[model samples]
Structures are given as structure tokens and as C-alpha cells.
Target: MLIDAIRIYCQKNGIQLSTRDKTLAADFFEHPHDYISDDYFNYKLHSFICRSHAELPEIFIVEEKGNDFLVYERIISDFCCLSQHKQQAPQSFIGKKIIILREQPKTLEAEALYATIKKRISGANLFFLPLVAFSLLLPFYSNLFNSRLVYSSSLTSVLYITIFFIFFALLEAFLKTSVYKTVVRATHDNSIKISKLLMYILTITSDDSAPSTTRAIELSSVSYWKAISSLMVDVALLLVFLICIVLLLGEYSIILFLYYLGFAIFCVYARFQSYESSLKSIAINNDRLIDSISLHNNRQQVRFTNFDTLRHAFYVKSLASEKLSHQLDLHNNRWAEILKLNTFISMVLMYIACYLAINTGSLSIATIIAVMIINSRLSAAMIASVNGCYSVKVNLHQIKASLTKLTQHIVLANANQLHLDKIEQLTLENITIEPHGHATLAGYNANFTRGNVVGVVGKVGVGKSTLLRAIIAQAALPHGAIRYNQVNIHNIDALTFQRQIAYYQPALQFFKGTLRFNFNLYGIHDTGRILAIIKYCCPAMTVDINILDDVDADALNFSAGERQKIIISMLLEKQPSLIILDEPTSFMSDDEGLDFLRHLIAQHHDAIFIIASHNADVNRIATTLINISNTGKHKKIFINTPRPTVPITVKPQGGLAE
Candidate 1:
């Protein structure tokens, strides 16, 4: 009820209230007059709407009091640029109707995406608070060594020290295990979350917006997590105690500790230098390997076919690999340097501090021996901290960069039970789809209505599959546009828009399972429908064996035509509004395929069919035929079969356009 009222308010004013805009609108509606003049809040709301809805091909004119003139006024000064690309910004606000889109409230950030995991991880680490307190009490337990302190007997003091040592050790073990496990879980969890989110952002949109740095960041995030999770608080507490006691011994001990720490920091920085180089090298090699696989697949191509080109490519790859190996070796050398240098430096520094203390009568021999033991542990902790910093540095930079990009495209579709409205007509206007800078299909204009089966006939590489992909809003259309029910696909809720249509490619990989297991794709068990489809399609060809068996052999026993029937049966069973099949029965004969196609088209008159096939028989059984050409040539269609005379209408099923 609140969303409907808000939607009415938005429609009256020409604002496109997107998936995240409803929350801001509601906040604004609380005190409408106050928010109208509240410049900062209005600015934030405007920015959010613009960013989240940037994927859509519409500009928003948020009619607020402050900065209305400056909102859509991004000036493109180049006259030639403006003329060639007429769709350039606020100037082309001609005959376009503005509809305000509204959606459920959602958090718009990378951190917001992982908010639940982060909160749980943070809460779990709260148990480490007692560890810090325990570290503070460590000195009290070690105080039995103080000769000046009066005790009943030396044996009694030894017993007290041993009992306390055992207690703290057990406590330390418990705290360490808890922290370590939490750290590892957090690392892996962060890795998986970032990998999926980053890949999603890359795969869905085609703006070349995702950077290589974003990939590098998510790739090695787990290692960085592991490195940082090691607890250093207890080690820090020990250092603090050592410093306090040594200060009483002599100031020279303090100087020695500071010197040792400075050297460790330098070693850590140098170690990180090698790590940074190695990371880049590893990433580059991985990219090259993927590229090489593609190159090998297309080895017969003009450039790749040349012997010289092949040799040069291999030479370049090998050269890069050599450099990577060299960097890795350098990293190893630096690690060894730190290990040996720290130990040698620790001994020297301890010797000098002790020598100075004894010569100046600042501390007794027994106190110096205790200080020696403390120095070793202190040095070890410093080295561990150094290593931890190196690992964190590599991952933290990329994580922040990825977060920044994800924050920009924050479309969160978390609503359950989304219903799709019936699409009356799907239209494409001058849609030219060219992948990888090569022209495939050009100027594809058509209208698809329910009950009308449009057969797309084209030669190989004529962009039939590309056109199918573009129609379903799967590929980004930079040249032309597509609309469903006269509304641009991008203007609708992305999740709901996707639900209305289904595209089935010819190269389908069916899971090796029983016919019953494979057919129930939506996890909806309908044994009766499966049996009926088999009976209608393949009644005569009866195998005198059981098909209900849930074995891999039973599923793979079906012939190519039989498998196609099964796939078609499964897709048709789902009853999607629009179905685009790219050569669904390429392996089957044209006559046999026509029988199935005709039956499917006639049976499901409510759903529109767009089949791309080479069969001429398809044209006779379809309402409209699309003959594709790459050189901007169009062919006439021979449509013999008339479509059902069903009136079409666009119904609203959600707050925004479906």
C-alpha cells in the first residue's frame, strides 16, 4: 500500500524511482517540504538513483529544489561528437516519455553485499577481548622470579610459577585456536564472496568498466586474509612488559630494541616489494595462458597460421615466464635474508645491551639473563608482524578498489516471488549486433507478438545466435535498442524482465542422469507430463526396458533426435512467455523437426517463438520469417500459416515495469 502510494507520487512528477530509490523517496515523503529544500540529502538521493539506474538507457530529471539546472547538464563540447552520437546526454530529451521506477529498499555497496558475513565474523572475534586481559596479567605470574620478593621457600615459588604457566598456556591455546579458525573461515568466505560478485559484475554488463586490478584483488584475497588473522596482541603485550623491565635495567636496552624494530620494518617493506612484483607476474601469466588457449583454437586464422607469429608469441610468453621466475626467486632470497639477518641482529643487539648494563652496574647478571630470554621472543613476534603486513598489503589494496567499483553498480534483487507480466509485443529497432569489432548482423527490425512464430533463417556466422542473445537482453546493444510492450528492456526491473523469456542454444549439456531426473529441471516432479510427451513424440520406437531407472546409462541411451525432443519437452513444459531457440534440431531431419515445431507452435499459442534454423520448411509453418544478411540486405518472407487472432495487452505485475 505504501509502495503504491509512493509510485503514484513518482509517476506524477517524472522521476524514475529505481530498485533502491523507494527508500530515499519514503524518507523524503516523511517531510516533503523540508526535503525539497534540504540540499545535501537531495544530492545524495539523486546520486544514488543515477548510479544504480545507470545500466538503464534513460536519464532521470529529479525535480528537486536545489541544483535542478546542474543535474542533467553534462556538456559535451565537441560538435562533431554530438552530431555522430545523437544519444549523448540531456540534449536529446525530445519525444521520450518519463516513467518513475520504484523498487524494494536495498544496500548499495560491496560491504553491503557481504554485510551478514562481516557482522558474524566481527561478533565471533569479540571472544579475543579476554586474551588481551590475560596478556596484561602475564607479568604478575612471572613475578615469582623477583629475588627481592619474600617467599616461604624457593620450592614454593617454583611450584607457584609452574602452576600459573600451565594455566596461561592452556588459555593461550584456546584463544589461538578460536582466532585462527575464525580467520581462515573469514578468508575463504571473503574470497568466495568477492570472486562471485566481481565475476557477476564483469559478466552481466558490457561497458568495459571492470578493471584488471579488480580481478587481481579478489584472486589472492584468501592469502591476505590468512596472513592478517594471526593474533599479535599477546605478542605486543610481551613486548610492552619487556620494555618496562629493561627500562629499569638500563636505557641502552631500549635503544637496542628500537634499532631491532626499525630493521624489521625495513625488511618487511623490501619483502613486500618482491611480493607485489610476483603478484603482477602471476596474473599476467594466467591471462596469457587463457589467451593462448583461444589462440590455439583459432590457430588456422591468418595471423596465427604464420610460423613466425607462432614463434614470436611463444617467445614473448617464455620471456615473461622467465621474469616471473626471477621475481619469485628474489622473493625467496629476501625471505631468507630476513630470517638470518634478524637472528644475527638479535644476538648482537642483546650482547651490546647486556654488556652496557653490566659495565655501568645498571642491572645484575640474573636480570640480564631474564632480559635475554625476553629479547628472543620479542624479535620473533616482530618478524611475524612483518610477514603479516606483507600479505595484507597485497590483498587490501585490490579489495578496496573492487569495493569502490561495486558500490557504483548496486542493483540488489533480493525479493521473493516475483511475477512476470505477459508481454504483448517484442520490438527491435535497427539492432546491429557485432561481437569483437566484426560486423555480424545489422539493422534487424521486427515485431514479435504472441501466437506468431517468427522463423529466423540465416547462413552460418550471420549473427542469428547474436540476434537471439540481444533480443533476450543478454548482450549490450550499443548501436540500436530493443523494447518489450513498447518499454525499453533496460527501463524494466532486470530480474523480472529476465523471467519473462528463455533462450535455448543448440549446444546444451545435459546432466548424466535418468530421463525423470533430467526432465524435472525446475525440481517440479511431473511424471505424467513426462510420460505423455514421450508417448506423443516417440510412441512407435519402444525400447523393451525400464526408463524409470535413475542411472546414467538410461539417460544417455537416447539418440540425438530423441535428446532434442527431451530438451524441447523440458523447455516447453516450463511455459515461458518468449522462447528463442538457436538451431534446436540441427541434428534432426528438416521434415521430422517440422512436425515437432508445428505441434509446439500450435499447442503453445500464448508464447511467442523465434527459431533460427536453416530449414525452409520452418518458413511455411511460421507466421513471420526473418532472413538475415550481413551487408544490410533484407529478404521477403513466405509466411503460409496464419497466427491465432488473440488480442494482446501489457499488465502491471510489480511496482516497476516487468
Candidate 2:
């Protein structure tokens, strides 16, 4: 029983014993049979090690006949002086351990994945309360305030009533827009205010959190289907209400009949307007979902940047104005077909009513015409509204589902950080970074110090940028323990950490603003620091700084080095605790590149510098050099120090010289 307990404890705690870690394993084994190796055990054991050699050790104890034997144990810590990952990769032992591993989907399977997502979201039920309320009320309003052309007061009374209703219509528009805004706010957060509905089409698309083209198309398809269902539900309810109103108001005289018909027509117009407003909300909300995904992923790549692009991609322009128009036109053609059918039925009924009236000597044609008009309007309106409501209902459900999924992802990301915290240095232990099928940084450890220079150098495909990405984002890392001052970064706000550990990659991007605008991206205002870094990185100002205010028609015109300098300068202004420079000097001349590096080291001494490069100059400046290479089943790492050397200059003869 004693041996079994020890073995069980080791397995649960991911304990392992190696030839080198035998003493560490024995220290754990020293505990009595009944001793519990819970959090207390971990704390006690962790406390036993020196601060310099302190590590999170995993010791494994295997059970044999009536005895507990040490299987293996390893004490791992950041290899700041060695390679990218200094931690043991437990995933490598998957076949001998866990039953299954999650496999990444192939790019070819993306379309199928999209379809599955659509089906799931489409199936979820959506609520359309506002549409339901509007549909129900519209019928009653149509009956009570029906429009009538007066034959008594000439055209004067008719004109007066028309103008009065126009005022009423304007009031309705204002009130509805206000109400829609309030609803949008309640459904979303403080970010979207009630006033946003006024220009909902324009403004919402401009939100930084809106989705890009790739995700939007997927979301839009789901939205389109959901809208259809909601529209059907709304139209069905309205049709029943309209039918009830028409039957009740049919007893009124001819003038009243005309008025009711006109009122019903006006109500139809209002329904269209409301549908348009709801569409704007849907567009804005869908984009928000996409933005949330990108933000959570921490992808610098921006997808759909504008509504025009989104609108076109979603087929919104053609669908609403063309496809929908065609559908409506076809419905109208069907209306002609259905109207003929209804008119024939009514004609037969009228003939019977007339015959009966003639025999009783009391009926008139005037009465027959009024009854027919109400009957025709009620039937036509019912069919149109119900069809429209179905479309809206389907879209509403899809939008809700998409948002719900996004919300879940956000919650999970937050939960992962609940136990993580932020500090000066981050250490990874026994980490495996799988960058590709054949390439990975396995069993690697690295330490990043605060306000110090650390350089990462390796051959091609060594997961340099991947390491930086993983540190800034927990979700971004394939697998690792990123510690911020000994606390796992998983417990801290990833966004805040990212901001603190800024990365500058040599990518081309220019904003639609002055040079000052680009520098102020993070809302930074230190102009003095900006100009200084710029001067150091690009002494010549290369592409003419004089055109800083000129509208940049083409960003490609600027040299790659100049673009990198601007980006680095912006990052400098951001003043992150850890700054990652990924091949920043890749495009600069040797003289300019050296100048850039010297400036970075001098100006940002307060920041921990991690540069991924193979430049001899960079290697010489790096406080530590870690090499990453993969062999057979596991990854290998080597740590070395920068050798002291003077500047190596090119001789006229091109012979070896130092």
C-alpha cells in the first residue's frame, strides 16, 4: 500500500527521475508512506532548492513487486544561457502516456470546417423581440389611423391630414432610431451606445473589433439564414393581426375603407425601414465577432478593413438591392398570380352576394367594392410580411450563436490567465514548440531578463519569431510555462503582457495620416524620443521625411530599412518592458545596421532586448547565445557566450582580415 501510494503521487504530479536528478527524486522519496505530496509537498520541496537553482521538478515513481522504484525525475528551469526552450517536452511521450493527441486540420479541410460551423450556429434558436413587438402593433395602428381621400372638403382637408401624418411619420422615425440604439446597447456592452444607430451603417464597420473578410463570409452566411427565420416569425404574427383588423374594420363605409387601405400601406413602409435598421445592427455585430477572434489570436494581420469591402463580400449590396429586389418582384409577380386567384374567389362570392341582395332588394355595388379592397390588401400583405419575417428570424439566430461562441472563447482565455501574473522576467521550463511537421524547438528552456539585452541566434527555421509570439501570448505558444517573475503568465491578462513585451517585425504598414499619426498609434506622445530613435535607425531619413504630412499613396516606395526604423521608433515610444526586434536590421547597410543596434542598446537599456538574428555583429553584442536544432525524436540545444571582438572590416583585396 505504501509503495502504491508513492507511485500514484508521482504519476499525478508529473514527477520524473533522471540519472542527474536522482538526488532530487530521493529527497521526495524521503517522505514517509502516509505523507501527502499535495501543494504542501510541492512548496516544501521547492523551498529546499537554492534560488539560483530553484526549479519546478517533476519526479516519477513506478511501482514494482511490493516496492516503489524511481522511474525518472527531472528538475527543469529556464535556459536563458542556452536555447529557446529549456523545458522537457512531455508531448514527446504521448504514445506511452495519453491515449490521444489533437491533430491540426489541413488547409484543404477549412471549407468543410466552415460548413460545420455554419450548421451549428444556424441550428441555434434566435429571439426577435423588437420585430415581434413591431409586427403586432403595426396592424392595430393601420386600422385606427387609416388614410382616406375626402370627397367633401375639396382637396384642402386631404392636404391637411397628409401634412399631419408626415409630421407623425418623422416623429416615428426619430423615436424608432432612438429605441434601436438603446436595444443595441443593451444587447452589447458600453462600447456601442444608443446614438450609434443614427449612422449605424457607417460607424459600426469602422470599429477596431470588427471582423475581417475571411471570417465575415462564414459569419454572414450563418447570419443570412438566421435573418430569414426571424423575418418569417415576425411576418406571421403581423399577418394574423392584420387579418383581425381588416375583419373588424370592414363594416365601416367606403371612405373609411379607403382610409384603412392607405394606413396599411404606410405601415408596410415603416416595416421596411425597421428591417433596414436591423440589418445595420447585424453587419456591425458580425464584424465585432471577427475582430474578437483576431484580438484573441493576437494576429497583427487585419482582415476586412472597411464596410464597403464587407458589404461587397457579404453580397449585401446585391442581395438586399438585387436578389431581394428580384425576390420581391417575383413575389409581386406571384402577387399578380395570387391576386388573380383571390379576385376570382371574391368575384364568385360577390356574384352570390349580389344575387341574394337583388332577391332581398337591398344590396349595392359600392359595398361590394369596399369589401373586396380590404380582402385583397389583407391577403397580399400577410404573405409578404411572413416571408420577410422568416428571413430576419434565421439571421438573428445565427448572429446570436456566433457572438455566443466568441464570448465563450474570451471567457476561456480569461480563465486561463486567472492564475498567471506579470513581472520583469519570464522563464520557460521543459517546453516544446511545434512550428511545423518536421521542425520544432523541443525540450528547450530560456530566460528573459528585464531591461537587459538577450539575443536568440540559430540556423533557419529554428522557431525564433514563434518564441517571441509565445511569450507575449499564452494562447499564442504551442506549449510552455511562461513565467513572469516566477508566476506563470497564464494567470495574467495576455493583452497587458503583450503591451508590456512589444514586438517589432519588419512588415510594411502605413496609416492614412501624417508621420506623427503613425508614431502616436499607442496614444504615445513623446515626440522627442520618436525623433531620436528615427535619427539613429535611419540617419539619412532615406525616403524624405519632408513628406511626412503628404498623403502616402504607396507604402512600398519606402525602403524596407526605413519602414523598420519607423516601426521600431514607434515601439520605443510605447516603452515596453521587453522589446523583441525580429531581424529589424535585415535590410539596412552594415554601417546603418550597426548604428541602429548601438542606438537600441543605449536608448532602451531599461528594456529586456531579445533579438532573433544571425548577424555576426548581433551575435557579438548578445549577452547570451542559444542555438536550436532538432534531431530524431527530440530537440537539442546549446548555450554559449558572446566572444569579445573588434569591428571586422572589408579589405580592398577581399582577403580574410580582422
Give the winner by lDDT. 1
How well is each residue in 1-658 modelled by candidate 2, as lDDT tens digits?
3344444444444332222223333444443222331111111111121111111123332222454222333322111111123343432222222111111112112233334333432222233333344433433333323433523345787677567656666666666566556544433321121112112222213234423432443445544544444454545554554554344433332333354355446545544444544455555545545645655554443353565564465464335445444544564565457446645654455455445554565544344444344445554555456446545454544444444443233222332243222247767776776655434566678787766677777667767777766766623654557777777665665444535666766664666576656655544334455566567655665544454446652333556777777777766654567777888788887777777887778877777788886576887777776555654254344559786587677789997568
Alpha carbon lDDT of each predicted model: 0.59, 0.49
Q: Give the lDDT of residue 56 in candidate 1.
A: 25
Residue-pair clash count for candidate 2: 60
Q: Can you list the residue pairs that collide in candidate 1?
A: 17-101
- The TM-scores of all predictions, comma-separated, are 0.64, 0.51
Which candidate number has the best TM-score? Answer: 1
Model 2 stretches with alpha carbons more than 4 Å out: 1-210, 213-365, 397-411, 415-422, 437-440, 474-479, 511-514, 526-536, 542-557, 632-658
